[model samples]
Target: MSAAHVPVLLAEVVDALQPRAGETIVDGTFGAGGYSRALLAAGSSIIAFDRDPGAAQFAQGLPADRFRLLERRFSELDAVTGPGAVDGVVLDIGVSSMQLDQAERGFSFMRDGPLDMRMAADGPTAADLVNAAEPAEIARILYVYGEERESRRIARAIARRREEQPFTRTLELAEFIEKTLGGRRGAKVHPATRSFQAIRIAVNEELAELEAGLVAAESALKVGGRLCVVTFHSLEDRIVKTFLAVRAGKTPGGSRHAPPVETTAAPSFQLSFNGARTASAAELAANPRARSAKLRAAVRADAPVWRAAA
Candidate 1:
């Protein structure tokens, strides 16, 4: 299969979801239709979503009666499917392989293209932020989202350089950052990787979208419904981990002096399995992208969905 068609942890996600005949599933991040296609083959109707306008092309061959694609953010899932409706929701987080492979989409520094990293077509491009944002804000985005320690120095350099000429292309900023960081020093990953990831996340508002989508999934799933999330980076995985832990009532520690926290909010979900599942060694050999991928799943409990504090 082509890289674009290879969904990470496909079999594992399907097994976790256990899509039965006549059931409905929400493929929240319908990147290349990999999970949606597999679920349909398993006899479940699919409600798939993708923010990218280009994603519709992949839905052409799917049976209209069994599958429907929504050109909207997955965070609005509950709005489309009422509370306690769908049987399953599966989300594959981060930029799709299809987007990275296309140069004009500008999701990858390895490719020469416009520095437009918005997941949807409507938002501010990466170039806009790189060229216009204050240096401190840029530094914070790199530090918090990318976990890059050299964020301040890089941001300062970017501010200095953009004064001469604005960054418009992906490789232009990448090579500049690489030089500012004093070359790779033989690191296995490219020097610009973290900065690129940070910019992409900021441009797309990905982490916030993820948190909202998870809450939407909770509101949309019926009792015993399955929710599976495949996260590609530590930030995404951390959010999923914390969300599940809190919802499952597995949060660590409550003070003896304080009231027991269990009474505050009932458990909304039960863990499908302990910890997170990583790609098997055999599967790892076939797809390098799966190296950082982790899958976490849970079954919806018969309790009300937890609402956020005012």
Candidate 2:
């Protein structure tokens, strides 16, 4: 599999990592080995992980000594590798372009293909969720993940339609959503875009995986090790923001009525930078997916790990 993936925030990630020779870095998402390749070029050894088996085929010609690919999710990082052994950990959260571009993988609403949306391609599909989930559950998923305001209407339509016949194809569901929700003509994007995002996220438990993966990355990094994350949508971005803020002791808690107290335990990492960094204009023009991408990074503090305060 020739890598068609365009690694988002490539230059920024390399700059943030500042990999040195012989240091082991974990490319937590390792979609197309973009970050891994760059790290190798920078003289760092890499232990990359990708749950998608498809990426293994793409690893064919990669130098085995400098880079190693593991067919596993980033959430399993701690289980798969020794803790606090890596010098840096980079996670590009969310689905990859490889998955979206492959129509048979069924990630994009623009393409016509099967309804299977599993990132690993080995689990419950979007069709299963649409057909089996309660309308309220589906509505919540749409509202939270897709940020779809018309979630109720869409969920009701999906529930009603599935009674007639289960959705099997991408275009079939996309067309149904567009027809039910009424697509906006001349819009930059299709109306089914949000619904597709909602369904795929739900099917893969993407957010949950991200949360687990963040904690795993935190645990896996050595002192002063960098944890770099690039999130695409607001949902993923919010989680990354909150996780970093809490870990860096930047989350605000008190209101005017109550006096503020630092409720969190001693922070495990210090804020490497204030806020998320976005790609430059040049990168944005090249990869439209980088338009909404936000890169947030933090360095593991030398202080001992602090368990969450109860």
Q: Hey, what RMSD does candidate 2 come out at?
A: 2.9
Candidate 2, residue 146: how far the Cα is off, in Å: 0.9
lDDT of 2 by residue, 1-310 (tens): 2334658888889988989999999998887788888898889999899988898876777888888899888998877667788899999988898889899999988899999999885888998889999999999999888989999999999999899999999999999988997776778888988888888888888999999999888878899999999999888987888777877877656444223446547788887788889989988777777899999999998755554334
* Winning candidate number (lDDT): 1
Residue 181 lDDT, candidate 2, scale 0-100: 70
Where model 1 places Cα greater than 4 Å from the true spot, the runs are 1-4, 253-263, 308-310
| Candidate 2 ranges beyond 4 A from true positions | 1-4, 253-264, 308-310
Go through the candidates in order and give the C-alpha RMSD of each one to the true structure. Answer: 3.1, 2.9
Q: What are the per-residue Cα lDDT tens digits for candidate 1 across 38-90?
A: 99999999999999999998898899999999999999999999999999999
| lDDT of model 1, residue 56 | 94
222 in model 1: Cα distance from truth in Å? 0.1
Cα error, candidate 2, residue 119 (Å): 0.5
Over all chains combined, what TM-score does candidate 2 have?
A: 0.93
